[model samples]
Target: MANIKIITDSTCDLSSAIVKELNIAIVPLYVVFKDVSYRDGVDITAAELYSKVNKLKELPKTSAPSPKDFHEVFKPYIDNGDDILYIGLSSRLSSTIQNAKIAANEFPEGRIKIIDSFNLSTGIGLLVLMAADFVKEGLTLKEIFARIQESLPKVKTSFVINTLEYLHKGGRCSAIQSFVGGMLKIKPIVQVVDGRMILGHKTRGKIEKSLRSLIELTMKDKDRIDLKRIIITHSEADEEAKLLKKGLEEALSPKSIIITSAGCVISSHCGPKTVGIIYLTK
Candidate 1:
């Protein structure tokens, strides 16, 4: 059997250390600012992207990688006779997976398998980590793929945003909604549902208060949450992310709670001071 290699896009929000340790390959998306495009994670860090946004007072446009970009990432592994298991960004959210499908057509059939995570950030990262473990246990590529599909719906992915301005800029929110929400200091807890982001609920208060509400909401289903690993992803919200990790720790005492910074592609839409909690369920 050919070795199975796991590949995921940069939007997984996994730490560079974790990616290197797991031997996971990442194909980055693009972050475009005023006609200048930089590969997410490769050319622009989230901090730099935020800096640019703050300076220009304009949100950058994010884009999926082209089919050619995916092709290049897939080619070397194909030549090595390894089987590829690519877990990508949600199909409903971006064309990253679709482009990956287009690239797969350039390679021999049966060697490449593309899966839509139907989730983003460390939500996708959780699935990729599971696939990596499956590979370690000597499972076939097909087995890993099947297991990932089974695990998709069990992922609980959600975030609380500090402001709606980014949503308005991205056209996900109406200007009036943004203006009103901003004035009210309304924070929305956006949940991933059926591969699309759905407004879960709204909390009216300071961000810290909203984060506490988010923790309460997440812990409601704690009994069903898989304790193996949990992820806290943030965009320029280190302290807030740490608070989330601490809350989960005190409540669930999960085996692993990883804090990773969201990359440019994710940060571009959610904007600064956004934090999300991601995990798989039992």
Candidate 2:
């Protein structure tokens, strides 16, 4: 058995199968609609969240897990004599990272390490996957921590939102402006830079151009890519994601490519047709 255990929150957006295979523990965030609340991946799913968003009068709101929630999730393994490494969503975007840190302090005598991934969704998922691989290879908790810290900046993520309506509804963009842009069918290509989302380029014609732009950016270092570990994640847009995957494979010809749904926590913000790519670089 691995001496160290990996833990992360639902915001990481990793699938249940991968989590189980990696022996990773996930603490769920909360999603509230009207008067009802549900645990992120437990009671709410990406498809369900998008369905509700389409029918509801108002957009649903998301809440980060509290320190108590983190404590509850951590106590199990820590008490069982496993060293814990709690990787979390970006500190810039949510207080979840801070909450995890607070909970880690609560067990001062136990071996627990909380790390702010400085990323969200599949961005964090990619990092957690790398950390899990290291742990499975029998690396010590300290070595795994050092590996994650060294690799954080080398991971690149870029995405394209089919429409800005979701960002507007979530208060990440101006409603009136995004609404107007959506009517024009403008697709925005965005990238995660310095731990925050920023606009990269925009096209008024098709999502294909936006997707092409993402690939071009990723393939800029085509001669030296470690293609064995490329990942693609989307928000309820499997068709588009499939198309993007096909295009990426033909272009880069990576050794492996992983495609999965971005969890409800991110889908809640990016909405239904967001597509993204994550890759590890030298």
Candidate 3:
């Protein structure tokens, strides 16, 4: 058995099969709509979350898993006498990491190390996958922590909001301004910088162009890329994701490219038709 266990929250946006295949533990977040709460990626799905958003004309609130939720996932590993390394969603975006810390503090001198990924979606997922590699390599917990920390600065995460409606509805931008952007066919790209989301280049006309912009930016440092793998995460943006996958294959020549749909926690904010290209640099 591996000496260390890997855990993450749903905001990682990793596909269920990959998570299960890697034997990674994921504690889900919550998506609440009209007084009803559903566990992200469990009771609720991205399609259901998007359906409610468009149908209700409002954003569903997403909450981090409680301390008890963390305990349930952690206790099993602790009982098995395994060390844990949890890669959490950006604290700037969610309080999932904080709750995990609280739960860890209550354990009997538990051996849990939590790293704030300082990123979102596939951004954090990339880090978790790397940790899984470390475990498979028979690396110690201390070594995995050092390597992940060393890799933090080189991880790049970015996405484009196909429409401004979701951002504006969440008060991230403005509804009126987003309506104007829609009228003008403005698609803005967002990048995670120091754990916060910031606007990047804005594309006009098509989402294909926006996706191209993301690929171009990622390839800006092509020579520095660790093109072993990459992630094309989206919220029902399959066509654009395909375009990105093709582009990455042609441009960066990555070995593995994964496409995963966002769950309720992410779809609650990014809405439908959002796509992000996440990668790591050497």
Candidate 4:
């Protein structure tokens, strides 16, 4: 078996348990509130993050891990004689992958490979797990890199915002738009297309309707879904996420459905009750 290490950033939204079990090294991003900063998922928890936001009445700013941060995480594994595969947040969304590349350059060539996931939350997590699986199968680093690149475009990521408050606070939408959307109970669907967030459909009435809309949209690709795994990730919306999970179970019947809470970085933007579906297509 080849000696290898899998690494990802905290924006991936994977649980610590899974990270520990897989032995994946995670370099944390930063969540800044005024002059104070905390490492996403390391120095902060989702509940605490939400509480701080509510108390401050503003969304916190998120930052990518620095090149130095990546170096610290990479050094131990390299010293142990292990090659590394780092699946990171999208270059379009943040400079995290760029920083990882800078850190990789400090090491010998071919010892590390960096992949731009072009995704966030569980979308990136899905790719990280896929790379880990390839490693466990004893695939060579070269072969695993090719497989990951092929699978990159197959990742499907979309989510529904339960409230427009956070979006407005973060300047994503204007106050008037937030007011009108709130009055009508309109939930906006955000889709990850070409490595950027684009507004998709808007569902009215209740949050449940939007959640159902997500399931319906996903079912359109049922025939092509990889079916190996599906992830439903939420920011303080466990019950709503469970509803979506049940609906997905009856409709798609995928082999595995995992539920994870979004980390501080994702939660800071999406706000409470935001839920997203992430999966791969064959």
Q: Report the C-alpha lDDT of model 4 over 71-190, residue by residue, as the tens digit.
A: 999998999899999998889989999999999999999999999988888899999999999988999888898999998999999999988898888888899989999999989998
Top candidate, metric lDDT: 1
Give each model a TM-score. 0.98, 0.95, 0.96, 0.98
Q: Could you list the CA RMSD of all candidates, in the order they appear?
A: 0.8, 1.6, 1.4, 1.0
- Give the clashing pairs for model 2: none
Q: How close is candidate 3 to the true structure, as a TM-score?
A: 0.96
Q: Could you give candidate 3's per-residue lDDT for residues 1-282 as a string of tens digits?
A: 446889999999999899999999889999888889999988978887878877987898878999999999999898898888999988888888899999989776638888999998988999999999988888888899989989888889888889888888788887777988999999888899999999778888888888888888888888988888899999998988898899889987788999988877877777778999888999
Q: What are the lDDT scores of the predictions, listed in order?
A: 0.93, 0.84, 0.87, 0.91
Task: Compose the digit string of candidate 2's lDDT tens values, residues 1-282.
Answer: 437989999988887899999889999988899978889989988898878877885678888899999899888887888899888888888889989988899885548877788788877888899888887788888888888988888778888888788888888888776977878888887788878888777767787777787788777868766687888999878888898899889998998888988887888888778999988788
User: Which window of ten consecutive residues has the lowest lDDT sum in model 3?
Assistant: 105-114
Give the winner by TM-score: 2 or 3: 3
Give the clashing residue pairs of candidate 4, or none: none
Off by over 4 Å in 2: none
Stretches of candidate 3 off by over 4 Å are none
When sorted by TM-score, best at the front, the candidate numbers are 1, 4, 3, 2
Better of 1 and 3 by lDDT: 1
TM-score: which is higher, 3 or 4? 4
Off by over 4 Å in 1: none
Better structure of 1 and 3 per TM-score = 1
